[model samples]
Target: MRPLTNTPTRYSWATILLHWLIALIFIGQLVLGFVMVRIESQRAAFELIQLHKSFGFLLLGLIILRIAWRLGNKAPPLPPSVGALERRTAPLAHLALYAFQLALPLSGWALVSVSTLEIPSMPFNLFVMPNLPLIESDAAEGFWAAVHWYLAYAGAALVALHVAAALRHHFLLRDQVLTRMITPSSAGE
Candidate 1:
């Protein structure tokens, strides 16, 4: 069977590496995020939460680099089998991720930075997370906290859709659709 897109030209090796790394970080974020919301805002829990936030911020940096790389490098075109609906949706999906990956952390940063939770953050006494420097009022912090959680929920939903689609392409479609992104380098894939 023929591939849907042209020989994958969209992602460079560096892009592929960062994509997978981001995926892992996002999965970790999901786990820790659940804990942060459901569990009490205890110091121990805060430690774990800080780990997630730190990694997410790292992802933030990488996502920016990935965007820069994508800007510079041509991505592999979608396979021919990819339908028009998918063609339209996929780009939006990627863009949504780019937006969320940044917004999610920044929102969280604002939340923790502003909230009076008094959690000991950052690992191994390395550094204290600098606050956003808000007024000692509840309304503002509460607003951003709500925004942070709401966005986290939205980002979670997007991840679910993203994974389900990948599985659909891999197992159901039985095409190189997933491989188009998973493949190591442009030349090899």
Candidate 2:
């Protein structure tokens, strides 16, 4: 087999941009979640939640673009040392991540839409977002809430694994798997 030293293995420019942007948004969401939900009385907590929701919507739209980009462009292959089991599971895990990332945000968005009370204030009073149009029932609202929570839990769990696996590749395997995303080659860069 060919050696996998520093071989360019990363998404296209657009794909990488989307990947990093979503990551940043997710990080913000995680922090906002801890602060807003945990310390309920803090000033600006509601606003922070709105910020989180808006970022989630951004992530939702970007995710669709990311999926479309993935379909169009061939993704870079796994690095040299990735086990066969990991190679297979990576795609499935990504699939799950994308699904959850999209579902949870959209569900939360829908919850706001179906809510009887005034939706929390967001920037510019442009807070209300478009709904799915199909899922308009109160039951659907509850269902989406459940989906939002469960998927968020699953996504968080997977993120831990994702980070651990990257660490494994970086420290244990001494491979360039993490480097691929971190530093693209001169060609890709």
Candidate 3:
């Protein structure tokens, strides 16, 4: 069975769970974001927006925990099949991924916080999430909205690149890079 902590060659169960959960939700958010804007009914769009916001907040929380877990656990070394250039750049790419993952949700939150409409964000109909301390104005809203939109698309592109790299490592290079994330290492295996 997969242990709770990482092994030399594979991720811990916690890390695998967090990684897949974040990926699934982030992909769903991307789809939801694209579709919500095109909805003809304002009520339907509003509902979808609320749901997106709720998930965004949830993503932010999970990201924070993931970051903490990552910091506490060192990732396994890249397989020897990985080139030197890739070895150097992989960490940079990961940093960018983490940055976008963090910034997208924050920009969305900021966008709503500064909206002229002043609609309160009630996440999942559970409770109202307080807006960030920023001056509410149309200009601020526009700025944040642009930031959020750009970040979302850019983040999506980064995610695609990340997936491509992982696939290359798994199929092209025929390495354990991808499988390590999918399955935990067993002792003496």
Candidate 4:
């Protein structure tokens, strides 16, 4: 059986699971965000938006856990073939990823909180989430909405870049970067 925690050279099963789970969910959320807005029916749009919010909340919690896990564990080192620029920028890219992962949800929450519609967010319809104490106004809502929208596009770009880089490592560099996440045992090969 696969190990539960990360080893010195590869991510543990838990980390791999969380990483892909967050990636898939975030991608779904991005697609949903675009599609739901184009929905014609107000009722249909509202339902999809609520689902989006719930998923956002889920992403928020998962990201927090991921960050905590990363902090507590040492990530496997980048391969020696990686250049100095990549080594320097890689951490910055990761930092941006974490920041966007966090900022996207909080901005969404803020957008909903200050919305003129005053719609309460019920994550998965399980419970009503409390709104932030910001003064409710059109300006506040617009600001948060803009923040949320822009951050989402930024996040999409980052995800694309991340994937491209990983592919480069896998196919071009012919390194263990991608394999380590997919098959931990391969890290030792």
Summing lDDT over every window of 10 consecutive residues in candidate 3, give the lowest-scoring window: 180-189
Candidate 2 wrongly placed segments (more than 4 Å): 1-8, 120-128, 134-143
Output the number of the lDDT-best candidate: 3
Which is the better candidate, 1 or 3, if ranked by TM-score? 3
lDDT of each: 0.75, 0.69, 0.92, 0.91
Q: Compared with the true structure, what per-residue lDDT tens digits does model 4 show for residues 1-189?
A: 666677767888788888999999999999999999999999999899999999999999999999999998778888888899999999999999999999999999889999989889999999999998888999999899999999999999999999999999999999988988887533342
In terms of TM-score, the best-performing candidate is: 3
My TM-score estimates for the predictions, one after another, are 0.83, 0.80, 0.97, 0.95
Candidate 1 vs 2: which has more TM-score = 1
Which segments of model 4 are wrong by more than 4 Å? 185-189
Question: Model 2: clashing residue pairs?
Answer: none
Q: RMSD in angstroms, candidate 1?
A: 4.4
Candidate 2: worst-modelled 10 consecutive residues by lDDT: 1-10
Best-first order by TM-score: 3, 4, 1, 2
| lDDT, model 4, position 185 | 36
| lDDT of candidate 2 over 1-189, digit per residue (tens) | 222223346544456667788777766766666677676565687677777777777777888887777777666788767889999999998888788777777777877666555455353357656554544567766776676667677777877787898899899999877766675444533
The number of clashing residue pairs in model 4 is 0
